[model samples]
Target: MDCRRSRTNDPDQWIATCPEGSKAVCEELRDLIFRWEPDLKESVNSNMLCFSQKKRVCGISGFKNHAQLTFYRGSELPDPARLFNHGQENASIHSIDLPDGLEGLNLRALRSLLHAAVKVDTEPTQPKPPAAPREEWPMPEVLAAALKKNKAAAAFYEQLKPTYQREYKVWVGMAKQPDTIARRLEETVRALAAGKKWAQRKEG
Candidate 1:
């Protein structure tokens, strides 16, 4: 199915369009989920079609060249092969990358695994261990005073890698609650200035 033009029966859900082979794989998995876990709910949250309970259990998406089945609580699941590459450690998100040529294989095993996974509790996730303490980025002094208290902003800043650190100074500095924003701006600043991600970073 071409998901770009498709919408789900529910106003909140939109079926996604991915590579042709990926579409088939997705449908197979979706059907199998219905067969195995009939009571599971489906909807779109954060603009992605998701299978969820409480938080989210899983999400399905199609992408260029390939597609992915995302487990929001991946780190909590058993992955003996360690195939997922989530760009950070101790995070729950992971993906099973689908390449071409493996299409049409009975996806029963995969579906069953996911159904079982939905039952596994994903909580008790450990905090991301700290990065080796490095010199705080040379933020402007005026910028520092402005930033000291906001938790979310500070969290954002810390997560950013060095390359994306500057956008924050510009964005937060302009806000009226420059300090609050600065404090809350950590994540954004780190993302913009350091070329890194807050979520990808293990949140302590």
Candidate 2:
């Protein structure tokens, strides 16, 4: 399916686009999500069927071989049943892969997870602690010299936060070869001169 194309808010329309093998599984999972909590607002986001209360709770997507139920704040939810099989490394998102046929599907565990997810969404949120400062990387001599030559680049570089400055320094410093360093230095200076951050640098 063309994921970039926007899908209708209708659940049926979203289900219609799923692979034939996963159509039934998607329907069943959809029913389960609503059945567990009827008040959730359903919408299509990034081509997936997403459920939300005060915040996004979960989403469902049907792939070629399996349907997936993703909890948005899954890392914070309890999962004693080990139903989650994907996105283990993700900070907040995690999911359960429901294979075609639904042969060994654990409805009880799935329902429990859905209940917990809903409860989490309905509760008042606590204030998050302040994030620690990012350590700044040392300035590379090549970047310093290039910035010195270009007044515009130096002005922009001076105004940037340490994180943004570190991005340029790290990129230039990582270039081990002379040719690579020279190329990266040129690109960095050009981007900085154009008022672009390291991430916003255009590919040549």
TM-score of each: 0.48, 0.59
Task: Write one digit per residue (lDDT tens) for candidate 2, span 65-177.
Answer: 88888998888788888988898877778988877446687788888888898888877654454678877777888888889899999999999998888889999999999
RMSD of each: 14.1, 7.1
Local accuracy of candidate 1 as per-residue lDDT tens digits, 59-159? 76655455567787776676654445442354567767666523653465566557656776344545655678655445665557534654555555667
After TM-score superposition, the amount by which residue 192's alpha carbon in candidate 2 deviates from its true location, in angstroms, is 28
Clashing residue pairs, backbone N/CA/C < 3 A, model 2 = none
Worst ten in a row by lDDT for model 2: 1-10
Estimate the lDDT of model 2. 0.84
